[model samples]
Target chain A: MHIRVENLTHIYNQGTPLERTALHEVNLEIEAGERIGLVGPTGSGKSTLVQHLAGLLQPTTGRVLLAGTPIHSKGATARSLRLQVGLAFQYPEDQIFEQSVFREVAFGPRNLGLDETEVKARVHWALEMVGLDPARIGPRMPFTLSGGERRRVALASILAMRPRVLILDEPTAGQDPQGRRALWEKVGQWQQETGMTLIIVSHALEELARLVERVIALRAGRVVADGPTREVLSDARLLRDIGLDVPEPVALLQALRQAGKDVRTDRLLPAEAAAEIASAWGLRRAGA
Target chain B: MKAIPIGMYVPGDSILHRLDPRVKMGVTLVLMTIPFAIHSPWSYLTLSAFIATLVLLAGVPPRTLWRTLRTVFGIAFLMFFLYLFTTPGEPLLAVGPIALTWQGVLAAGGQIYRLCLLVITASLLTFTTSPMQLTHGLEAMLSPLERVRLPVRELAMVLTIALRFVPTLQEEIDKLAKAQRARGADFTGGPLRRARNLVPIFVPIFVSAFRRADELATAMDARGFRSTPHRTRMRRLHLGYRDLLAMLIVLGLVLTLIGLG
Candidate 1:
């Protein structure tokens, strides 16, 4: 579904002394099948905005439109919006409750009023999409799995719903490098197979750089920057001024350029940075 | 959910807030028993007025107290009707087949008033005293029972921890509920279906609660927490003139109430 958020503002604990404006006059739009990365420092209202998109939170000021329909109007439309927009929350495993992984992943599809066979098929497809061996992992207890497996199962649970728009908040948060890579690969494959619109919120710049084509940065409840990934991630001074770390590959290339090497600092991924550095060094040596 | 103010404690700088919690605890206990001892309408009126004054003096918002009492109104009104129809007394009015008695109406009014007073007074105690102070007060008040081999200190500690975790668990439940709701878990169904839907939400809460408890245990152990007789407190409880004055006022009121009853 195409998503549009117009002048959205969210104030937590409104009318109370502890009321806090978590988001302030935020405006953004996402076309169907767009892959966008949402990055921000802690408390930048990234999660709040994402929650609004899924209709989990009502906006304090403005409205969120899903396919030209306002989602805040609660009823059948809200239920359909929830099915259309899947939110894989940060630390999603913390809310995992089903006994077996299969049942856990099947919960969302079952709630969609699908038949048992369809539910089973979705579960199996989701598990396979997340790179988990369905036959081996399906019947195992969810709580018994390792942290990474649990995280994958949580993602699979959301994936089973086959939401048209998937919003993953910190999807790769505490995983090791291998786990992160594997999960991202699965997510990429899933996105390719389904053509779903994806919005990923993360602190990992490298992953965001490699995965999403567009980047949006938020600071203190306001959108600070929104542009192509390379344009946003390569701006070290801007990100550093906001107390956010630029992606490591971007930082490395910029550091080399600052040290008097005629290198391209706009490269965001490690492979791109490596190729840029090799060609820059070779050109410099030949000229000398 | 965000609009509802769930907690009772309202921070303030009042005489009740400053009074030693042990003395406050004693006063509260004595005041709670007044509803039972006071039988006459005049005495109940005096006690109710006294509790209302205490609530005001503590700087507690009347709305906060009423928010709690509002939930009991249906039950209280039901009890009033139950007494009106069933109690054996002189009938004052007739509604078709049911005879409403004057004595039954009076009895129900007294019962409901007494209950409101009880709940208000209890809510006042919680609103004025912090959970930590309540814990210390309970520990100090029940210390004498320690000589009888009771685990008074441990019990108080448990109370304190449980009180502390109430807000934490509430937040966890809220998050889990939202997450479940986002996954198409509809709670607006029949009672049976709602109950069935809640299983996914609650199981995770229980699991996380256990995990949190384990972490809390480890954290407490790291801080060298242990139940012992020789433990020292960071804030010592002492009875001052204000406490004595408050106690004297409650004592006089209680005596007058009993005499009138």
Candidate 2:
């Protein structure tokens, strides 16, 4: 679905002593099949904004428009909006309840009221997309799987729903470097195959750089910058002012440029950074 | 549903909050037993006033107390109706074969009132005392049970941990429920289907809770937590004049109510 958030404001524990605004007049639009990254420090309302997109939370002021319809409406219409927007939470293993992996993944499709054959097909496809061998993992209990496997199962359960838009919150949190890389690779592959609209929320800017086409940086519940990932990431001072670390590769390039070496500072990917640094060193050697 | 309010200890510095939890426990025990000792309207009224006063002094939100009572109101009303219709006395109102009597109505009202008092007093204790203090007080009170070969300290630790996990588990369940909703698991259908849908949310919660329990055990072990019969506490319990005066007042009220009615 084409998602648009307009003047969205969310206040948690409204009217209570703990009342605080989690999001303040935040506005953004995600075109169908558009891939975007939501980057912010902790408590910057990243999770709150995504939850509103899924219609799990009502906006205190303004509305979230899914496919050109206000999803913040009451009752059945809003619920239908929720089904079309799939949200995979961080540590989604905590949401897994089915005894077997197949049954767990089939939950969303089954809830969508699909036929048994269709549900099974969706579950199988989802498992395969996540790089899990469904025939091997289907019968085993979800609790028996390793942590990484369980996380994949959790993702597959949401993927089986085949939502028009997919929002993943910190999918790589608490993982080792290899696990994180593997998760992003699988996610990227799945996105390519399905062409689903994707919004990924993470604090790690570099991880999101190569994953998303556009980046929206938030701080203190307000959108500080929203533009192409490369342009937004090029401004190291703006990122630092919002309490976000400049991604390592970007910082390295900027350091070289400051030392009077000619190099591009906008490359955030490791491979591109390595190539740029190598070429820059070779040029410096020739000049010397 | 929102988070369960089983152990919602609202922090405050009221006299009731500062009183020794052992004394608070003693008062609750004594008040709970009073209904069994005396069955008079005046006694119930005195108990209600005592509870209301403690509730007021504790600085607990009246809304919180009322929220707790609201859940039990239906059951209490049912009890009242049962007593009103079943008891035999001079008939006051007749509807076909069913007759309502003044004595029966009064008896029902007293029963429900006493029930309310019991609930209010218990909630008052939990609202004023933190789980840690309550656990420490329980250990100190049950220390005497150690002479009878009971594992008093271990039992107290278990109770404290269990109380602590109620909120943690509640939050976990809430998140899982939201996740299920996001996946189009409707919990608002027919009773049977709703019950069936609960499996998806609950199974994960059970497994996660167990996993959390295991982690907690490992973490505690790593921290060198041992269940020694005697251990130094972070806060020591001392019965000062305030605790003694509160206990004496509750005791005096119970005695006066017993003698009068």
Candidate 3:
């Protein structure tokens, strides 16, 4: 589904002495089948904004529309609206509570009123999609698994719904190195197959740059930068000013330029940055 | 969710806020009880004036105080009307089933006045004192029980952790509920169905809470909590001149209230 956030502002615990504003007049449009990365410093309202888009939170002032219909409305449109956008929250592993992995992964499809056969099929597919073997893992209690495995189970629960939009909030936070890469690869493949809107929120800029073409940077609850991945990541100063690190390759290019090497800083790929740095130093030695 | 107004602390820099929590709590107890002795209008006026003065000195916004009062207004009215018909006296007016009596008017008026004073008095203590201060004060008050092997320190720590977890647990429940709702789990249903819906949220919360408790115990042990029997405070509570003055003033008011008869 196409998501639109218009003039959105959110305040937590409104009308109390402890009340705080988390988001302020924020706005963005997300097209279906688009891959986007949401990057921000801590307390920048990134999670709050995505929750509004998913219809988990009602806006304090403005509105969020899914496919041109308001998602927080009191009528029937909102009743089915939230189901279209699947939100895998931060620390999704903590959300698993079902008795068996089969029931756990089947939670979403069952809630969607699918038949038992369809639920079983979807659960099997989603578990395999997240790299879990359905036969070995499906019959066991969810609490008996490791944290990483349980997190995948929680993710499969959301995937069983087959939502048009999938939002992963720090989905690979505590994963091992290979586990992270494997999970991201699966997400990429799933989006390619389904052509769903995919938004990933993470602090790992290098992984984000590899996955998403569009990058939106937020700081202090406002959208400070929105552009293609290379363009946004290339602005090393802008990212650093907002207390976020640039991709490692982009950082290296900027460091070379800072040392008066006259190297290109707009490069995001590691091979390109290495080639640019070698040529700059090669020319410097010849001129010297 | 909005903060539960009556028990929530409103941060302020007032004389009442600086007073020791024990003294404030004691004064609240006294004020809350003195209403039982109040029957004459003069005594009620004195108590109302005293509470209003306390409210002014605390610099709490009138609107915030009104919220505390508004919550109990319905209960106060119910008690007032119940007293209006039940208490016997000369009949002022006769309705179909009940008679409004002159003595009933006095009795109900006094009951409502007393109930309001009790609520305001209790709310004032919490409004000026944080949960941490309250727990610490309770610990200090109960330290004497340690001589009898009552495990007072652990008791206080339990209370402190429970108080701290109130908000953390709230956030956790909110996150879990939202995650479930995202999976097309509708929360709307009849009573049994609603409870059944909550099972998905509450069961995980219970497991998480237990896991957190285990981790907390391990963490506390790692920090040398079990190595020493004696405990120390980062900031010790002291009874200063203000606490003594507040005690004397409330004591005088208590005497004044009792002597009104």
lDDT of each: 0.86, 0.86, 0.87
Docking class of 1: medium
The positional error of residue A127 in candidate 3, measured at the CA in angstroms, is 1.5
**The candidate that achieves the highest TM-score relative to the unseen native structure:** 1
Q: Write the per-residue lDDT of candidate 1 for residues B167-215, one digit (tens) a residue.
A: 8888888888888877888887789988998898889988988888999
Backbone clash tally for model 2? 0
Indicate the worst ten consecutive residues by lDDT in candidate 2 chain A: A279-288
Question: In each prediction, how many residue pairs overlap at the backbone (N, C-alpha, C within less than 3 A)?
Answer: 0, 0, 0
Cα lDDT of model 3 by residue, B1-261, tens digit: 545546578899999999999898878888887788677778888989999999999988777888888999899989999999999889999988689999999889888878878888898988899999999888888879988989888888889999899888988988888889988777897999999999889998999899899999999988877723676789899999999999999889888878885
Please estimate how well model 3 matches the true structure, expressed as its whole-model Cα lDDT: 0.87
Instruction: List all candidate RMSDs to the true structure.
Output: 2.7, 2.9, 3.5
Against the native complex, each candidate's DockQ, computed on alpha carbons, is: 0.69, 0.55, 0.69
TM-score of 1: 0.93
For candidate 3, write residues A1-288 as lDDT tens digits.
888999999999787667889998998988888999999999998999889889988899999999999999887678677888999998898888889999998988998888999999999999988889999999999988998899899998898889889999988998999888988888898899889999999998878877898999888888999999889988988899889977888878777778887988878877667777878877433332
Model 1 misplaced stretches (Cα beyond 4 Å): A252-264, A277-288, B1-7, B39-45, B95-97, B222-224, B258-261
Off by over 4 Å in 2: A261-264, A271-288, B1-7, B35-46
What TM-score does chain B get in every candidate?
A: 0.92, 0.92, 0.89
Q: For each candidate, give its TM-score against the true structure.
A: 0.93, 0.92, 0.92
